[model samples]
Target: MNVEKIYQGTADKVLRGIPASSGIVLGRAVVLRNEIFVDTHKTIQNEEIESEIKRFDIAKKNLVAEFEESISHIPPNAKDLKAILQADLMMVEDKFMYDSIIKFIKELHTAEAALVIVFDQSKQLLKHSTDELFRERVTELDNILKRFIIHLSKGEKLSEISENTIIIAQSLTPSELLKLIEKKVTAIVTEVGGITSHLAILTRSYSIPAIISLKNATHEISANDEIILDGYTGHLFINPDLTLYKFYREKQKRIAEHIKELGELIGLPCKTKDEKPIQLWCNANNIDDVKNAKIVSSPGLGLVRTESLILSLNRIPTEKEQYDYYKTIADTAYPMTVTLRAFDIGSDKYADNLLIHEDNPALGLRGIRYLLAKKDEFKIQLRAILKASKHKNIRLMLPMITSLEEVIQTKKLLEECKLELLNEDETFDHDMLVGIMIETPAAALIADDLSKICDFFSLGTNDLTQYCLAADRTNESLSEFFNSFHPGVLRLMEFTVNAAHKNNIPVAVCGEMASHPLATSFLIGMGVDELSVAPSLFLEVKEKILDSSFKQCQKNVSKILKTAMLKDIYQSMDV
Candidate 1:
């Protein structure tokens, strides 16, 4: 089974996967693929060297101008798009890149060959990056370089777009996405991508409906085929009939109204109708995420994945480098606590330096286990976190801990790093709190014991659901089994919250469940102290919380836990 087409409607010609962006639009399909392959080893004559250099310089200048022009045309709301385009501009103007390519050109290589060689070196380096965002940036770089190659070769660039175009592609780089936005494309459907992909992020920022990871979307749909893309539900209908089109058209209106309603709730406290205060926090993936969290009035930042910094640079960042990144986030979210989870790599993300092959990677070396095994790497990250603790609002959190012993060992290791920092007469805030993620079933069951040692417990519902249900969340066929609302998973959540509160430790849920409307009320009812979600959904989830009643939710939860059948639970909860 293809994981990309994990979700689909009963209709025969519908494709689905992850919902990258929300909204609905009906437009003609416009398949796009902008791939440029070149032979870098091609040699050139001595006389052509000077012309080659001139051509390279001219193309480089044109590419930079093109990127700047693209950025200038992007709507003001698309902040990330502007930043990405600016980065592309910088890449084109990079001094080292020019020097390296010029040197290659002087060695009797064509300009195109030189450009490809120099860019390939950078690509090879970034190919090992474990961070998805950085990898997406590399894809954007690839697109820009390809455009440069096309310009130098005097070839045409990407195909033109038509009005009301619904782009169908195997994948799109950020630059391609920006180009689509510039063309006023209505929607995007891709064969491969995820929610965090730059293309997906850009689509969402541009308010363009997009469904990605729909396996073979380009092959399945033809050009000018009437397409209805429902990005909110992750479904794309090829040549949809009038009935389906009308249904989605109505849905689009309702969604727009609902979003407007949610926007009104922004700046309001995340409290139940009965006046129960619930702390709302945003999960930060980068500096922009932190900024969005601030905009959404998120009380604090929860679950900042620290591995991204290393992945983006494709190297184990030095202590100072890591410290700087953490300090920036901490300062950006000043007066608000920033909980930084130490490198949660392995399993889904494989760093270049640390390569481990496991048949059952999910259950194997990942998260805390990976961190513990790589003590040197762990120590460096800890030192960086401790150094950044000087901001006072910084908190350290450990991921994938299935045992209390792991928590104790991590604390001891943190102390060792602290002692080393002290020996060097470095200043750090030792008073910072250390939190642990209750992700595994073992961790949830022993939440009581772990709470005794940790300051807080962050329920990682995504992994916890997978582990509790004994189903791989990434497996398309087992999607039904990987339910966060499963009785067992819900019971574990309830138990963890109870245990954490019993020990006077606050429990926060920083997972997809917290952001989901269906699960938000139940989480609040379960006595979850904090709800952390994607910054975009923070206001909507808060709106749900504000509209809910704690007492009613508690009552509903009691009935839900008692219900034995999943269908009955769903019917009762109206989810």
Candidate 2:
């Protein structure tokens, strides 16, 4: 792993990490730091106020221009990063923020100090945000502010990188990543980040090969050392031998071919070989989700995770804020429906404000239980969803409902929220369909009763499977037991689907089960009307469905239901 040894083309090889993006690359290593130091706490004299404000304005313009320039260089399919960059751009152009900073400057705060004060308030709030994802955004925004301050004070710039360079670092903020991207950096390796991190999202958007959470990556990787990055597999081969090089080169070609095939299926309907029309939708966390879903011809958005918006901004959004955010998704999806799920808050999503603590958070006060107790917060969200439904096709969905009583109470609250909106003369959709996620065993078992009140049912199989099996999906030690395709889990899905259909309601599978190609056939066979998944897996699942006959899939599912063992189910699928 040393520089000399790597150069000699023989060293410890094959580092595994989280696959952040998919692609293959062979290049020399380039190291990067996560942030640039800046003095952001200085005060200013009255005489310096105008000049300082001018300086701040100039830096803001420059940063925005840089971000806009970066957007042009990235691939068109990289809509996620493009939307993110546009959001940052919106923040830079925020009139209220600008006025506040100018006011601070007039009050004798230095330009940098004013900038720090304004953004620090947002950062502090984000620190306590519900989801860990938004907390990560706080750090990202901090790095961005620091970079802007550095640009204003010292005119600092990114380190120069040569072509075909793979960036290795302890961490990378989106701003810094873009800097390297401008120099045509080939790939990236980071020691810390997750699938939802800005770095991971950006890499995927840009189609860059990236592996994250490779512990001690900076310590092991040397500058200018030859490295092979297989981001699809989360493998990094250092100082690879000729044989290893040839193996990866061939692997790259196969992956490229597979992607090309998948790409060709875009815009095609997801109909089975027997001509049964199956609806394809996508789960979305933000506006980018709607954009991606539309690109893949997803007829609608199955899940618009509202909690992410709350966490990302670090607070419960105001009616206006929520309206604007939801409207953006509605606008993006246009005539297509957007199923906005109510916040399924829990201790696990970093919603400390929602719950104090629970010994077993998985089975604790969460989902509908938490929302019911916090009626005011629940009302705010419901009202917002109703208002957004005025503009585009929208369906309001309640998450984590485990009983008929919860459904009844939620409907009552929905009526109350609608009445309040009517009193205020606020425009909203009065007839928007309200659905519930059948994620709990209790919910699935009693789905017949719940479906009577619900307009639709969307299966959250990820949680349903874990709850049914009484296993934590995240617990590596219990990994063997966290089977979503278990006979018991499949039976619950079957039961829920039948219950919805019995009531003449449409049911969609919007969980990880639907995204998997192996499970796609079985789910189709089981009479699932719709499948909602990540946009990246759309074509893959579509291909599976197109090659299957619904009648055959029904037979396969029937065989699975009668089977007693997990091994037998796999044997039936030839997995």
List model 1 lDDT by residue over 357-437, tens digit each: 554555667788888888888999999899888869999999989997788888899999989999999899988899999
Global fold similarity of model 2 (TM-score)? 0.67
Runs off by more than 4 Å, candidate 1:
1-17, 31-158, 191-199, 213-225, 235-263, 347-362, 420-426, 469-482, 562-569, 573-575
Q: Give lDDT tens digits, candidate 2, residues 66-138.
A: 7778767666655556656666666677798789888888888887778888888767655543334545656
Q: Native-vs-model 2 lDDT?
A: 0.79
User: Model 1, 532: alpha-carbon shift in Å?
Assistant: 1.0
lDDT of 2 at 96: 82
The lDDT per prediction is 0.79, 0.79
The candidate scoring highest on TM-score is: 1
